[model samples]
Target: MLKKSVTFVKGIGEEKAKDLHNLGIYSIQDLLEYFPFRYEDYRPKDITEIKHEERVTIQGTIQSESVLRFYGKKKSKISTRVLVGNVLLTAVFFNQHYLKTKLVIGSKVTLTGKWDQHRLSITVNECKFGIGEQNSSYEPVYSVGGKITVKGLKKMINSAMEQYGNQIKEILPPYYLQKYKLIERKDALYKLHYPLNFEDAKKARRRMVYEEFLLFQLKMQAIRKFHRENSGGASINYDKENVTLFLERLPFSLTSAQQRVVDEILKDMATPYRMNRLLQGDVGSGKTVVAAICLYAAVTARFQGALMVPTEILAEQHYHSLKALLEPVGITSELLTGSIKGKKRKELLTRLESGELNIIIGTHALIQDEVQFHKLGLVITDEQHRFGVEQRRTLRNKGLNPDVLFMTATPIPRTLAISIFGDMDVSTIDEMPAGRKPIETYWAKHQMLERVLSFVEKELMKGRQAYVICPLIEESDKLDVQNAIDVHAQLQHYFRDYKVGLMHGRLHSSEKEEVMQQFSNNEVQILVSTTVVEVGVNVPNATIMVIYDAERFGLSQLHQLRGRVGRGDAQSYCVLLADPKSDVGKERMKIMTETNNGFELSQRDLELRGPGDFFGSKQSGLPEFKIADMIHDYRALEVARNDATHLVSSEEFWENSEYKYLVMYLEEQGVLNGEKMD
Candidate 1:
């Protein structure tokens, strides 16, 4: 019944149904779950009690006739004085000329807006022409579009609730409801949409947040259970001596953090269960070398290993580094990127299939259908968030239940990690390598480009390379920001004596690789590029990164771009060449200069830009919670995760009659298909 189409609601026909569908509401259940993003508190407040800039609802009798006046072209304001208690407050409504006729003298009105104590005026957002009931004062705001207005959505929701609210069954067991002191699902829905008071709304939101989080957690746990129980995982023998020898062969020693993460990864690989682990390390934290040590372990255990990265350049970089590190230890490695095609690709594939190639490092080419492994054991993906979930799964499917390890330089906050990566074990390398200097970051206006460049010139004179990054590839009529092409040209002209190479997304893969190689070899002292180099490009000598229009990037991205420099022993610097006009933009610049901690910056970024933009897009697999905020309702998420983990671990809970509805719902959602569960 909950799955019935929303057209069943009164006054909602085929046309209105189409409008609701655009809101991702196809069924009655969706309509109920489509919680309001915010609420307008129309509960009248005492004029004396209201603080300045506080949004409040004030009920008063009209003391004067509204005087409507025309403002700047096509704009008008309706001003009137209303008597609230002993205070005579002025209310102004902008562009609402139609309200002039309604604001008659002596008529009571309830105005909701931001109050200015100094002027004793209210910049009214909405006005009701009466002393309205308290229940009607609390207005829920829904994100509606197309032909649907806020009033229309509210009406439709009210109609749906009137008809089908009773049909809303509780998914949680009675014990959980009592244990958590949660309100009934039906009651929660009603109060959420039409609350009598703010407390009612808060309680209702708490219930909904818990329900959404629990359902999501249960789904995640179910998928994890299905995988762990069904997919027969490989168990590699732990050869500690070989790992120690490999670590000794390295020119540098592993940081304590890296060593700790390595221990966790090795432990997972030694386990019988497939290693679904996420290795989160800040940029320049040496995740690649840790991955190399794991690959070496897999090879020594007589199993082949594969390392997949996001781009060809990173693949090549990893190939060189790993080859230099592992080849001496009898590990035959091969680089197989998309560019390695025709005969060369064929030979690599043949060698890979026959186990002649102990390790194959490549881009998405490693996941191609033709690529096979003789005895695949370990699969490590760098910058794992760059690839979609299906892409990672496809790569893992190539082997016979190969232990999978995902590495990301992006430092996701704990709340996000718990929600998004709850199914996987997470290990964080928080400590940087010893002897590395923190990158000196500065925020400079665009006018200071010459001074910034002069500093870059000094670094180049010392034989150290630098990267000049821009937000756009070319001049964009839509945006007024610096472009890589123009910047490249200007930098090339400015640094006439030195070589300046240009690289952007428009460049061919081979072209990008050639430019990167030149930069690596120091043939190009200054590389002007877009964000293509944001991922992985190891040049120890590159001591400077100058980012133009840095305000165009999120705090996390700016942190990532800054990470490109500061990879070497020498003191590196990052200059954000931006004159941000907005406070948020200026805050981003300020935050960048304030600290080098990626996790702290990411938390702030999440608060400012939100999860959608933080992940680059909505398609980034960050779950869209209707009511539960990963940041605000994090306690609910943690509780839900704990409950879900507990329930999933108990086989009896799956068969218990009390949880039958949950199992049925999960099965219906395809979270626990019959085949996988059985």
Candidate 2:
């Protein structure tokens, strides 16, 4: 059944099959397993009790009707106002001119839809025209839309279920299923797609979530086993004397947390196996210094070390910062970025290959075939989320299982980190460095825009620079938020005495470097940028940061933006200009104003928003679960992890005929990209 392509199903032509492929529904088996993301629970309600932003169903007489049409490239839309019961509501339907005849004046109908208070209207997705008792059942709400409607997907799924649902084979061990108290696989699929009640839907979801987590954890266990079998080169010599001197040479002492994490890293490196560790810390947490120690250890062992960053700006920043720190101790490093080209790049590569340079730092350019290391023993990547597992493996493959140390500024909850990045040992710098003054954060509404501008101008007048962040690089009709170019123009006119600079992802490398240089040199007093500046630049003189539409960002992001300031001894302020209407947005603002602890905020962010919203899914480099949520299905995750670990580790489990489904599930998932367990 798994081998049969979706084209075997009726109506799934070549074009339709391609669309299904884009949605990861490759075969008939995939179609049967494709479940609804949510259920639309429609319960009839009295018209008198309708609240703003509430989804409701009401049976009322349409006392009156008025239609307004719009002429455009698209078909004309009808905006009809209906007097239902005592409530007057505007119902707009797009390109459904035929509905005009069906929705006659003085007709009694049951309408169900979401009411947009601001729009003073509701878009009717469903309406029944008869006064009859109907069985209330949960309606499956899939994520399909546009070219492929939800109704269309439902038809295909129904067809598949009728034709192939009975042929679908289970790939989970019976004993494990009974142990977890999970529902039958076939039953769960049926209930998820067409559940009669909320309880049935939840039961189906529980079974599916546990299965998803179990499969994922099994893959991780296989990966861990693979790592253990593939031994790395001998441990890099940890010269105690050289390390002590390097620590003493630092301008500031490491915090106890930083030191503890550093010890964990060294311990991993001192082992015979390759060290795979993750260093997590907030911005300005001295994580770089800890990574430098690892790099130094690599150098002491007569092996090369490379630090790869996500951006050229960040690469340049780290290159200069590390050079300043390492140069005094007779250590030399070279930069090999995309910009460094021709003879300069060639010479740097030659030196790097010949062991002339002990430390090589740059962006993704370091992973290129030409940039070979003489004896690379350590590889550190900043913002590890930007790179995928295969990319990290490619870098690691450059050397003989080189020690890989991933670094991240965004704090991840401990449980989440274990679930997503459990491949490596996790060490966190929970404490910030000494003497780093906490940034003074303030929340301001749109009414205080003038006051915020005035405060920024005052700070600029004192020769201290300020940063104004916008959510977008350019204006969009779809988004009602401040953009960088528009904000830069406004600030330029508003603060004529001050020089305002602009930066965004769209800018070229040289252009970005020029703008950042100008800002760093105080030649530009006010810098308007997007989140691209969230990590790299260190502007101590910049004392004020004003973020427009602060609610548009996550708590972790707001904290990172706040980190741009407070780098100097001068008191700094982060003004959050926002008027969030949603409960979650209000909570984000309250959390930002309340606590500066990144770990705590990260856990809260995870709880408030799913992991996907906290950080980009691509950034996590983790599998996107169809059913398992890191927060909601945490217990399932833990149970799955425990069982998966035990199953993968036990030779008897893999060999047992009764447990062969365990291997089949792992194989079907293509976990570890089809690595051979045997």
TM-score of each: 0.93, 0.77
RMSD after Cα superposition, model 2: 5.9
Q: How close is each model in CA RMSD to the real structure?
A: 2.7, 5.9
- Specify the highest-TM-score model's number: 1
Model 1 lDDT at residue 369: 89
Candidate 1: residue 533 Cα off by (Å): 1.1
lDDT of 2 by residue, 43-108 (tens): 666555668888866566655564747687667666666666666778777777777777777787
Clashes of each: 0, 0
lDDT of all predictions? 0.88, 0.83
What candidate 1 gets wrong by more than 4 Å, as runs, is: 70-76, 94-102, 132-137, 248-251, 338-349, 368-370, 388-394, 674-678
Q: Give the lDDT of residue 587 in candidate 2.
A: 94
Give the Cα error of residue 5 in candidate 1, in Å. 2.7
lDDT for each residue of candidate 1 in 395-499, tens digit (9 for 90 to 100): 888888899998999999988987888778889999888777999999999888889889999998898999999999989999999999899889888999999
